[model samples]
Every structure is written in structure tokens, then in C-alpha cells.
Target chain A: MKLWLTCLLFACMPAWADAPTTPTDAATWLNRVAQATHQLTYQGVFVYQSQNIMAISHISHLIDNNGEISRLDALSGPPHAFLRIDGSVYCSFQNKPSGDIEHRPHHSFFPEVLPYPNTHLNNFYQVRSLGHAKIADHDCEGVLLIPRDAYRYGYALWADSTSHVLLRLIKLDAHGQTASQLTFTQIDIGHAPTRAQLSIDFNDKLPIKQSGNETEPKAVWQITNPPSGFHRVTETVMTLPDHAQPITHLVYSDGLATVSLFIERQTQPNTFHQQGLVQQGQMLLYTRPMGQYQVTAVGAVPLATLVLMADNLAPIERK
Target chain B: MSHLAYANKPHQTDGGHDYIALISAGFDGELDDQELLTMLDRHQSDINASCWQTWQLIGDTLRQSPSTHPSQLAQRVAEQLKHEPTVLAPKPLRAMHTRHMMSLAASVSVVALVSWSALHLALISPHTTQLASSAPASSHAIQIAQIDPARLASFVAAHRDFALSADSPDTDTSTQNTAEPTQ
Candidate 1:
């Protein structure tokens, strides 16, 4: 009887241990996704699709004592690769050296799509779980973020049930159409990629055009009526290779989405004189001539949001 | 929005008004054989040729063809001129017969096209080509220009930098430490 009871307890203990301990709430799952993105060591091949375009890429992310390092190589189209180490991004195109090592904040790509845990995502997005599904042979629970307003797009995310890592993401338009998608077709978790896999050799002899350093300039332009939830994040003046005059760049973000506004004086005789709107995949661009300056706004938000920001842009008196 | 109104307003024109109309008609693909002859004849004028080159630049920029460099275009134009068969030149229209209404319409279209082309050029990048390959075909298919890939890159790069920074670990409000994968 003692032996039978001990065996029975051992069999029953497996059932207890298998019971669901994973959080069912979407916010907790989102937090887990964010944490896994930054903390985990993983490598995978993912397919990114937007409208009629589809691209396959390989991504390898590793977390070490020096912090996070990642490499993404495009497996389709023209050869392009990006190496991100902590906050810096280095890119190479057509196997040619991209001269500048840009020092900027992290830009989330596939598997790293969640906003930081501190963002007020709940205020702008209704987060809910869409149950479980199998992705890349891994059982994943889906989290849907429905936008509360028309200003921003919605998102649906699938995170691994056991590892809590995000495996797939779908960007939804205002009408709930899939505007873009990124899904891993194969992935290996909990293993660090070899250093050789992450190395980028820039020994090519192609002439590399240098993107000069950026400098912060005084805020002379202001948007009087920006869309709600959107706030200015950074403003700087940078010299573009083609433009003779410096362009003032301003970035605005509503937690998940971002819009960049570029302002430059119309010094050239052939400056753009017409106002127009264009859409490419999920991105929208609006440009209008403002007095002697031309303003161009680009973002992945709705056209209304871009128009509102561009129309409200006004010059402010510096104190 | 007010800029649209400003752009639409008519402005004073120089002696190149008639040439501008012909250039605009050529861009719209509405030029006839005779009009083409007249345009080719007027192409000798510095102002008309410059306007023609500008229009070509806009078209080339929209097409994003690498061979559309200004110097290459000039060479191509010279080559085509060398191959042209000499023929009787068409009679030029009388100054009084110049269509002012047509000229005005052409001017407006040119303004719209210039503006449209500029914005398209600003937005397009190599990344766009990689992503826009699957765009649905249409009669009025939108052309993605490549006037300044570097500028577009800067905007996109900056935007991504800031957008992702919001959720970065440095700014995380949660007290949970960045955890390792469960072995």
C-alpha cells in the first residue's frame, strides 16, 4: 500500500505541475514578450510581408555581459544586413560598407515588437488575449491590441506559451486588414549564436557615402495641435547628402507608432512647390510648402493624423 | 491645406509660357507628331531645353532608374539628335494664336506634377523598393521616386530609433529584472 500510494502521488504530482501557471491577461503576456526580447538568446529565420512585398530574413539575437547584440541579414532581394549592438546600428548594402555607425535608440523588429512595460498602452489600446495557436511548431498564445482611436493602427501578437517570446506579429489597419506581418518560420531558443554568425565584414572597396554626425538645434518650429497621445520625442538638424541646406527633423511618437517631420528652407530654385499625399504599404507621406520652408511628414499612422500635424506646424519665437 | 490654394493661384509668366505648355503636354503624353516636331525645334532654346531637362529629371526620379543621370541623359539626347533624319520643319504657330487657356492648364499641371514628384522622391528609399515590389498594378500606378534615399533613410532611422526606445529596458517602469530563458 505504501509503494502504491507513493507511485500514485508521483503520477498526480505531474498533473499538478502541468497545471496552467502562465498569466492569461494580455498585459502580463505583453510584458513577458518584452522581457524575452531583451533578455533571451535566440536565432531564427522570419518572413516579413507588407502589401504585395514579401522578404525573408535571418535574425540572431544574443544577450551577454556587455548587454544585447543582434544581427539581421536579408535572405531575399538585394543584399542588405544590419548589426545592432546595444543602442547603435550599423548597416551594409549590396555587400558594401555603410560608412556611419548610427548611435540611436533601439528600433524594435520582429520578436521584439512590444512597447516598453512603462508605456500607457492600455490607455490607447484595448489589450485582450485571442487564445492559443501553433506557430513555427511552438504553441503560442495570441494577444490582440485594438486601437481606441483612428490615429494609430492595431496589432495582433503571438507569443510562445512556454518561453513567453514573441513569435509572430501582425499590424492591422483601421479596417482590421493586415497591413504588415512578421512571423518566424524557424527558431531556436535558449542558445547563443556563434560569434561567426553575427560578424559583418565591411572590406568591400565600393565608395561609401558618409552620413555626417547629427546635432541638436534650437526648436524653432512647433506643432500647435498635434493629435492626442502623440508627443515630441526628439528634434535635431542633420545634413543630408543630396541637400545643400540642413534639414530640421522632429520625431513624434504615440508609444507604438512614430511620425517624422522634416523641415528645410527652400533655397534651391527647384524646391518642391506642390502639396501632396502618398501611401506606401502602411506608411503615409504628406508634403506641403510652408512659406519659404517645405515641410514633409512621414509616418505609419493614418493620413488624417499626418495632415493634422503638418497643417498645424507653425514657427515659434525663440526666447 | 491653404498651400494648395496658394499653389493653384495663377502667377505671372515670362516668354517661355508657350514652351511650358508644350513641355507639359509632352509630359502628359498628349503631344502629337506636329507638336513633337515643334518641341524638338524649340529644344534648341536654352530656356526650353532647361525646362525639358527638368521635366525629364522629374520623370526619371519617379522611375528611380539608375541610368537617368543628368549627364547620361544629356548624352542620350545628343545621340538621338545625331540620329535624327533631316526633314522640312513645321510652321510655328502665330503669336496671336497661342492658347492662353491651354497654357494656364499646362502650368497648373506642371505645378502639381513638380510637387507630386518632389514628395514621391523624398519618401522612396531602397527599403521601399524591397517592400513595394508587390504593390497592385493600376492604370494610374503610383511611382515611388528615389531622389534622396539618404534623406528617407534618415527619417525612417530616426523614427525607428525613438519609437523603439519607449519600450527599451533603460526606460522600463516595471521592477522585474531582465530574465534569462528557462533552461
Candidate 2:
């Protein structure tokens, strides 16, 4: 009688055995991250490391109730820095203006992956709270962004305890190995980020105009043909400094992904069959051919997603 | 443009590092400067030299043809042959655009490819079987030869690009067909 009672007692409390220490409340944590990035004013230095690339970016973001934002990233590689005052993006390279990049607003959900319907994410990734840890000397709550489908990589996020901002993120491949990591080394959250810090120190000096706007007339190319859910936002004609001719630039974005199309003079024959997947740190790129143009589409997305985006680039008409 | 990467670090894997893959990106104007730097960094020797040569070759080909995709070669000439507009004399000729193709794919994805391939050894398309059916390997019992789809799904999932074409006498189609028989 005693033995049977003991066995029954253990069986009745089985739920206790599988429980994790300080389980993360997934929904609450997600809401917290969304709110913090959108509502908070922050300044920090973070490193983005991927398959074969390592870049350090210093960002200062200021957000007010208006939803209008201002930011700057002192990029340590590629020898350029980016500054944004409101909607305009200023690049120190290409000697371009401190204005908008004639580039289209294709599928860029940076700072925050906006317009993202959380419903879709749930289908692809199993959100899990993986206890607590410390990142950059700050206490954090850990959550695993496990892939429910093999179409994309998974991510692990460690969000700050007090503010709930993501302090670190690890992107993993199919074998659950680290493919890339973005982690904050120093951070400060508050109402004001100094204007001095927001200003980009260009060329170790101020930016000098490269020249008069050599920007040719914007191309009227509209991709009357596009993959599903994608739309052409901008089409422009750009002059290459190294190459002698101006090229057509067409950009398209589905609410969450972007594809860049360049139509230049074809300089080679299609003798080589180069297809499949390629990687540069955390970014996966897919190369394919589209009419007359060399379509090379790269994004920090799943290889399948990039491949689909590249394959469906159709010609635009004057509609 | 720095040789420091080659100088400082050891080669991670010899045969697998794909420099041309990234440089191919440069040819299209997609790679940002940092990405270009990283590629140059990892491949400072013969690999880098070969990648530049490949770019030159591609550029020559494109300049020569300036009218089409650099990767769609003489092989797909057959597909282009089908592209020739046929006249249903006096009737309005409609262009079967890419949208139509994708719509067809989305609709059929449910009926033919993904679902039933779960069990059957071979699934062939009702309308088209463009696979050459000659990929060597599977020569065991119950040869499930998929013509286009039930075959196409696995092909799409694995390669992202595929077409179906088959000829008789070559069980190559049988062995290569990606289709699984109806469950």
C-alpha cells in the first residue's frame, strides 16, 4: 500500500519535472521589446558579426511621441557612416547629398520590424522563454526564436531586464550553430541623446560636396511584373563613377523583404551556370538571371526567401 | 582592399569558400563596399584573381548579348523556342506573363506537388514534364520516376529553379523525376 501511494504521488506532480528555471513569459516579453524600441530614446555601440563579416555600429536614436525619429550609425567598415535626421538618409560615401537615398523603401524594417503581423511569425518560429542571463553587464531575459520551418534561420534574443530592449541576438543555422551575432557592448536609455553625438564626423572632417548632382533623370522603369505581395517603390538612373555608363536601378519590397535590380550593359555571355546559395556573414544571397539584367538579390533573410525574390523579378512597363 | 585578412587568419575551409559567389554579387551592383572588402579579405590570392577573371568573362558575355540574362544559356534555347508567339490567325493573341505562371504554380501547389509527394514514389504533371529524366543515381526496386511535379516540389524546395523535359529509352527521367506516387 505504501509503495503504490508513493508512485501515485510522484505521477500526480509530473508537471514539476519538466519546468525550467524562471521561465520567460513570451508574450509579455515580446510586447515589452516592441514597446521599448518604439518608445525609448537610446544610444549605444553594438557589433554585428556574421559568417564572414564583422562590423561595429554606433547608433544614437531619439524618439518622441510624434513617432518621428532621428538616428546615426558610425559604421566602422566599408569606410562610411550613415546619418538620418527624420526621413532623410545621409551617406558619407559616394559623396552623395545629406538627403534621402534615391533607393526605394523596399522591405526595410529596421530599428523595428514594423508592419509585421505577429501571426505569421508564430507559424514559422516557436517562441520560447529560455530563462535569464547577463549581456553586456546588464541582466536580461532569454528567449529562443526556434524555426518551425526550415525556410529560414532561428534567432535567440536576450532582452534587458529593466527596459526590455534586446541586448543581444544570436542567429543560428539548421544545425543550431551560431551563424551571426549582434550584441550591444555599451548602452544608455533615456529621453535625450546629445546632438553632438548625432552628427557624423565625416572624413575625420566635415563632408565636402563631391560635385553637382550628377544624378541623371530617375528611370521610369516600373516592374509591371513582380512576385506576389511585392511592389516597386522607386526606379532611378544612376551614374557609376568607376564604369562609364549610367545604370537603371529598380527596387521592390514586399512589406518585409527588399530586392534591388540593376540593369547595366551586359558585359559577358551566360556561359557559367552559377546558382544556389552563398553567404556573407549573417546575410544569405541568391544569384539568378532575369531578362537583360543581372539580378543579384541579397538580404538578411532565408535563402529560399531570397531565391524566390530573385526569381520573380519581372520587367516593368510605363503604365 | 586589405590583405590583412589573409595575413592574419588561417584559411577556414579550402574547397568550400565561394569568392566568385560574392563577386558575382558585385557585378550586379548589389554588394555594398563592406561586403566587397570582406570578400577581398577572405580571398587575397589565386581565388581573388580567379574571381576577377570570372567577372571579366561574365561582363564580356553580357556586353556581347546585352539582350538577355547572362545565366540562361544555349540549353534553354529550347524554352525560348517555345516562346515564339504563334498566331491563332485573326484571334487576339494573349501573352502568358510571369504572373500567370506564378498563379498557376500557387494553385497547383495544392493539387499536384507538395501534398501527395508525401507517399507515392513518382508524381508526374498532367500538362508538362520538362525534366530531362537523366540524373544518374537511383537504380533500385520500385523506380519512381516523376516527370515534372510531384517532382517539381522537391526540386523547387531544393534548387529554387527547375523545368521539366523528358524523352523515352532513358529511365534517367524515371530515376531523376522528383515526383512521389500518390499516397
The clash count of every prediction, one per candidate, is: 2, 36
Q: After superposition, how far is residue B167 of candidate 2 from its true place, in Å?
A: 47
TM-score, cand. 1: 0.57
- Pull out the clashing pairs in model 1: A52-B134, A116-B167
Task: Give me the runs in candidate 1 sitting further than 4 Å from their true place.
Answer: A1-28, A92-108, A200-210, A268-270, B1-183
Candidate 2 CAPRI grade: incorrect
Candidate 2 Cα misplacement greater than 4 A, ranges: A1-32, A51-54, A64-81, A91-119, A200-279, A282-284, A300-303, A315-319, B1-183
Task: List DockQ, one per candidate, in order.
Answer: 0.04, 0.01
- Per-residue CA lDDT of candidate 2, range A1-319, in tens? 2222333344334234334443344444566676676567877777766655566666667775545444435355333345545444444543332322212111111234322222344544456655678777889887775544434445667778888776776756545556666777887767555555555453243222111223435455555444444566455555433334455555554433345554454456652224445453344445544555555454544555555555655654555
Query: Per-residue lDDT tens digits of candidate 1, residues A214-294?
Result: 777777778888877788877888766556788888888776778889898988644766577655546677777788988
Question: DockQ (C-alpha) of model 1?
Answer: 0.04
Scored by lDDT, model 1 comes in at: 0.61
Tens digits of per-residue lDDT for model 2 on B77-178? 334434633323242212222334345445544444434452121111211111122112222222222223322221222111100000000011212221
